[model samples]
Target chain A: MTQVALMNQVVEWVNEAADQIREKLKSPIMVEEKSNRHDLVTNVDKETEAFLVEKIRTNYPDDHILGEEGLGDNLSDTKGRIWVIDPIDGTLNFVKQQENFCIMIGIFEDNVPILGFIYDVVKDEFAYGGAKTGVFLNSQSVNQVENVCLRDGLIGVNGAMFCHNTFNVRDIAIEAVGVRMLGCAGLDFLNVIRGKQNGYISNLAPWDFAAGVALSEPLGLKCSKFDGSPYDILGERQYFLVATQKTYEEIANY
Target chain B: MTQVALMNQVVEWVNEAADQIREKLKSPIMVEEKSNRHDLVTNVDKETEAFLVEKIRTNYPDDHILGEEGLGDNLSDTKGRIWVIDPIDGTLNFVKQQENFCIMIGIFEDNVPILGFIYDVVKDEFAYGGAKTGVFLNSQSVNQVENVCLRDGLIGVNGAMFCHNTFNVRDIAIEAVGVRMLGCAGLDFLNVIRGKQNGYISNLAPWDFAAGVALSEPLGLKCSKFDGSPYDILGERQYFLVATQKTYEEIANY
Candidate 1:
């Protein structure tokens, strides 16, 4: 299938998933701890992931799937066409605030990032694109972000990482004009992609940042591990960082 | 005029002012520095303040106005009916991100906070209320926030303050589950008022936090200086802090 047609189909599936979440939110959501009390997963997360997996399997059976809720295939390697999904990127926010959460999907061909989609369900902003398609917010095309330095722009840091000075993120926050913590990686990626903030740093799983890296890398953003090394695509809980070109250089050197 | 009627009128005027801002954003905004390069003010800020002040003066001529743009009265005491206004809270966000900024206004009678309103223009969420009216988000009535302790809640702190550990805010950040910095005071206040987060701390002027204090205090949130002392309403740049009942006690004692 053509990339455009594939993207259109995926968008439809995502919209349907969002509808399910919104409907479920009207009732009480059953929440459970994933790793700890601070780490959460709701029933909506599993439901959304299941629905998306069903749609993908029915149409693109050849493609491998890796999803957050474990409803998809158990892929050992990042080979061939792989779809990475995080049904609810900010599960804690989804359960607590019922906002600031997102649905994210990344399409990779032969371990090379191609197309991606990050949808803010409550705000109704669907950011999608990749190298070939470029980037877009809904209907409007997004341009490459201006190269701003860390001293001149806002940076989003993981709340715990910033406080604990992990990976020297506290030093980066001190250098930036300001720091923001939205508690959602997808929304943070959207802000960086749209030039709202210069960069973001967080420890993330493959599904958590696959879509963001695909969307941002094409927009002149630099994506890597916290120490400025290239990150493994299918790695677990890598210290992820994405930033404007100059800001990236500044942080990496620091 | 009755409090409800007065609130309706103010809401109308605020809506009108928001309309003006939306129209003005279509063109290039004129930006200026207030205290430093980081402290910004825009043409929209001055224009919005002037508009609100005019409406208030025309409708209630006896009330004094104290506004961020200096388009209002110079009050030495909080003795009479007074309207405090921050034309555009988070001017940096307005100048750069074009989101997260808010219009805030507070009413006081004889040193007592009577009513307050905070309008998130881009999101179209208008939060308004006081001791007598109870808090509200648009048409829905908002209930008092649960008495969550610092360890179980997210806290919003001024970015610089958190980094600098101003007024022992670093200790508070260590106690909370997480920290967020939105760069907009009014939006932070709205989040705290709605129980989305448990607390926020910043150094602010009367205009910067008056409306938030008015709306939040009525919902059983505690408001005070960062040092756990009573704050002066007409004072300049007091270390302002707001949190849920239990969280307040926790932070105050810490």
Candidate 2:
């Protein structure tokens, strides 16, 4: 694969998808309940996912795709060049606030993450990068987040999990200065990449955090399964990403 | 007091204070703990309070003032024209996220709220209003919100209060589609007034919620004490605001 060439196409495709998302938001949205009333999906989510899938398939016909809206391939293994996309990461937020929702894309080649993108459509904050190059917020190259301790920084938690005290989230929340539930996984991790938030703990799907892991590692951010094990980009699991090693260890105590 | 003239001047003062706040956030902040590490106050908070206090005193010397930063008068009674200012409403948010914090101003005459302003400086979203006229987001007039039920719309909750299940927040949270914790009372209520959130429940001080009452009443939103009593802007207490009357009653059940 031509690494830079593939990255360029991904970036272009992301911007195009973002523009389409803004256009779709202008119309009255049609929402449907998914797993429950709390889990939602809009026509825009499906349409956006289809758009991304079509673009990838047309450009790289041999590539495999897994998507939130299920408009792509049904695959059990991450064997070849594969793409995972969440066209609208926070559909409920989009329906209610028309804000904070984001579009995320992650590309893996032979099970190794190669490219990633997270676009906050409302804020026009595009965070994208890969392991070969450091992360970039918009156009500027970035570094790791500040090493703020658990007692000093604000954290974003998965609201449902926190409410259920999954992984003892209530205890972790208490150790942190404050908790924020923005209701969007992509935007929450965007805050972590920018150093605005110290960490985010959640039970996420592959599409929910693939882009985040792809963009985070280059910035020295640690993405781990809650037990401090290596994170698998292909699985749906509980995960936590911390700004620094100190915060990672402190949070693990809970 | 010439109510219109005072309102215009107050808007001007609020905007000027917001400008200074943006400037201060760019520099290193000096944060001090208040009630706990979770409760923070910054030098910028004190300076901004002093700035607003000086402006009010110079413009209206006889007016009494109650402020979070303690840069104004300490009169216990709420008689006469008075102002309440929370220089930095989400002090911890300001110190950590550097976003979501707000400068809130509520002015009252003889225990009746007159003018209120909630400036979300980072987003450049200014929400202001009073009893005579309707509420406005930025410069556009806003309505009383969607009138959606607790089961349909999003709700903003105070982080610490939710953690403690204060007012049975966990139960209240379950009744809603989702929960958001923006950290700043001004920003939280701003979401409520604009129809983005159906309700917000909190244990807020007078300064933290006085401006919200002043703005919400004009939009016909309900602001009540936890026991379903009329909310008093002059007193600090537990309160909730709802978009629809049905929701108002439904939330009270929790």
- Per-residue accuracy of model 1 over B57-133 as CA lDDT, tens digit each: 88889889999999988888888899999999988888778888999999999988899999999999999878887
Q: Which ranges of candidate 2 are over 4 A from the true structure?
A: A237-243, B236-243
TM-score of each: 0.96, 0.96
- Taking chain A of model 2 alone, its TM-score versus the true chain A equals 0.95
Cα error, residue B220 of model 1, in Å, equals: 1.7
Interface RMSD for candidates 1 onward, in order = 1.5, 0.9
Winning model by lDDT: 1
Residue A168's lDDT in candidate 1:
87
Model 2 earns a TM-score of 0.96
Interface RMSD of 2: 0.9
TM-score of chain A of each: 0.98, 0.95
Question: Per-model C-alpha lDDT, please?
Answer: 0.88, 0.83
